[model samples]
Target: MDPLLLQVLAAKQIPSIGDDAMLLQESMVELINSNPKAGWKAALPSRFSNYTIGQFKYMLGMKKIPKDASLSFPVGSHVANSNLPAQFDARTAWPQCSSIGRILDQGHCGSCWAFGAVECLTDRFCIQLDVTISLSVNDILSCCGSSCGDGCKGGWLINAWQYFVQNGVVTEECDPYFDPVGCRHPGCTEVWQTPQCVQKCKSENQVWSDQKHFGVSAFNIQSDPQSIMAEIYTNGPVEAGFAIYQDFPLYESGVYKHVSGKLIGHHAVKLIGWGTTEEGEDYWLAANSWNSGWGDNGFFKIKRGTNECEFEENVVAGMPSPKNLNSALSGGRE
Candidate 1:
């Protein structure tokens, strides 16, 4: 073992981790040594260096779309993308929105569900109005109601989207990331508890903050490649959920496809676009919240069409009212 590798394991307390860490490391090392044609490198990156698949679940933390929410709205038929271009990215469609290459870190909270929905909403809202404004993932995570799940214990992207339709999220300035209570906070998880809605925007001084944000509507995409792609082309990006594997944390870069890891847990993310690799492999670009230090600078590309990790199964999207954009234009944060 390399002394540096041991140091990382020690610093991260990996020695006393779950049963799969050692196995994942062994597999990754052997595969890398073999030098396959894959574009990305794999190893136990810091994000998954010390944690097991079970603990990783907290980071992914995406619950199922509530039956009521899914059924409330009549299902829309899957739209075909046959007429669409072979390649389309929200980043290029509306550069004015400035949503391209945007990544977010959820810190220690299992609020991927909130981050995904809010991120998509933020992008679409910005694209729709052609402006730049950072919406509040903290607001969504803390106050979206029980319907979104145990407030960071893991929630559904669909639930979060619906909540946004009823009541959208504020900006990061209004309610910053509340790691102490909003989530597990990176190094600790022994005292797991569901946090309550803090409603920080309601502060006496920022009394007008609550009125600055609004959710206009929400919808779900059909579980088909064309449907997913068409949704991305039409909007900005869509919130997606899929099962993750132990090998995911080690992803360095490239079009990722499950090679050797086993079932870890379900995670939610923002699906940006699709592309075929130089080697002709198809992939879906996604934004992750594990910070810029991990994965492809806080983003990852997974195999496309096959739903490599179910990235297309539970897709959700949202709309923000023009009222929110007006507030943003006026510098909503007084």
Candidate 2:
């Protein structure tokens, strides 16, 4: 084993499986659970047992930008905090919109930038226009090209939203995500090449153009907790990009804080709501794209108000177009 790799395992307090075995979930769980002060629980998820340290790094693919990058999208609006609730959840607020609670898997791809955007937009369409549609994350990942980013390698969160407004995205029914190795399958660490952009839908009956949905506008929300809460309270869920630390993959439940480990990479998720834990820790609820088997059933709560993990910064969202919705139903005349 490389001495550097051994040092990393030592730093994480993970026992060596000997020889070339990298970090294993079992050792990580043992190390975490043994600590009485560890706020969150850890588990040995069999599905991720074979994941090497390198693969874990690639699993998260949300790119980072300068602090001033928010200027590109700008704050869409501000809301008064006078009536803000102590707790809120998008799933509860929009009970009819099943998309709000859906837990999607990026499936061995670093297309979290695309998954985060499409997931939030799918919920927004249901909340805004009362239309239920699973927008295609694949369309954004494979089709947006350089305008979005290097496909599964990583991408900008802002560009994903911008693509929704300018180019629009088709329904999942039209171009569903390609997952050959199911997310639940163990030892699935193969990185996928982005699928080629297919202009047409898989179902011959549905026209790709007619199945498309457009956004009216794309904007960022002020990083302040009140502002982010108000935006989701009124419009729906928003896409939040933040840095991921090595400790994050071990998260089970509790308001996550960077207790230990090094910076792994950046990742994006659907910022769905906020709440206060029984221990009085403030947290922002988010939906991750690692499927239901990870974290708190594909959901996580990170430290809120303080911008822990930089989750509050660079929040992005958009409005669905009623005009485009009607046009799609009639014909491709938008």
Candidate 3:
């Protein structure tokens, strides 16, 4: 690895504010600018050749990429409506979300579906149940079965929620799992203990109730994504979708100027809040699990309103409130 790249990675391991981290990231970018090929050689090896400097920098904190890195789609495919209410301004809405807490990213795995499902589950779980519990993505990743393939390839978020409904999830600790190796073990420490439903909900002609122990709803965004994002931030963390730019330029600080790049895949990230830059451009505050080093201490902002970074408008899945129960069946979207 290039000595300078190694230094940047080392500095990231320590906890720091997003602004400071951005500053260091800029310094690293400058180092690479001076020697492009050498820097690419050091920061991006074969395993990382598919990623740009920014993408590779983000991956340094993760153990490995999930299997579906090449299969993600951009958010532009599902924009439905665009009429905005008077109060909805990207500039203000972005900062509001950022102020609340740090955002998170889910890296290259299709486990994004898992993270997305769980984040909304956790947030709503806290609000509805009055309990602050970090539901286990590890449990879903480990036990949802072979039908969903291995964690790396990809799985539907709805399927994960269905698994949770029937099999009442255990704490993440009991499972201690990760993606690309979905549920490698059998026999959970705590068995899902609940009554079986004699009859399922018929709303969607599906055997499972629309009111399964946990349920998620999908929606389409027509206008400014920031408006919907504001709703999610106020309500709690939401599972928002985005296109992964493999070639996002790596800079230590300042606003991210757009560049053409490959659309590697789609990902689910936790929407903590929104914020704006000194110049008043809008952005959504996101959290990434790639570790604390990547993007503003495991967090970063996506441009709002450009249609490039629109998230909430493309509602992939909205988890319904979970009931206290045990064991649900697993299958793809109906």
Q: Which candidate tops lDDT?
A: 2
What TM-score should be assigned to candidate 3?
A: 0.53
- lDDT of each residue in 19-49, candidate 3, tens digit only: 1123123334444444423212112222232
Error of 2 at 272 (Å): 1.0
TM-score of each: 0.83, 0.89, 0.53
Please write out the lDDT profile of model 2 over residues 126-146, one tens digit for every residue: 999898888898899999999
Measured on C-alpha atoms, candidate 1 has an lDDT of 0.69
RMSD to the native, candidate 2? 4.7
What is the per-residue lDDT of model 1 for residues 118-150, given as tens digits with 9 covering 90 to 100?
788778777776656777777778777677787
Kindly give the stretch of ten consecutive residues in candidate 1 with the minimal lDDT sum.
6-15
**What TM-score, to 2 decimals, does candidate 2 have?**
0.89
User: Cα lDDT of model 2 overall?
Assistant: 0.80
What C-alpha lDDT, on a 0 to 100 scale, does residue 37 get in candidate 2? 52
Sorting all predicted structures by lDDT, with the top scorer first, yields: 2, 1, 3
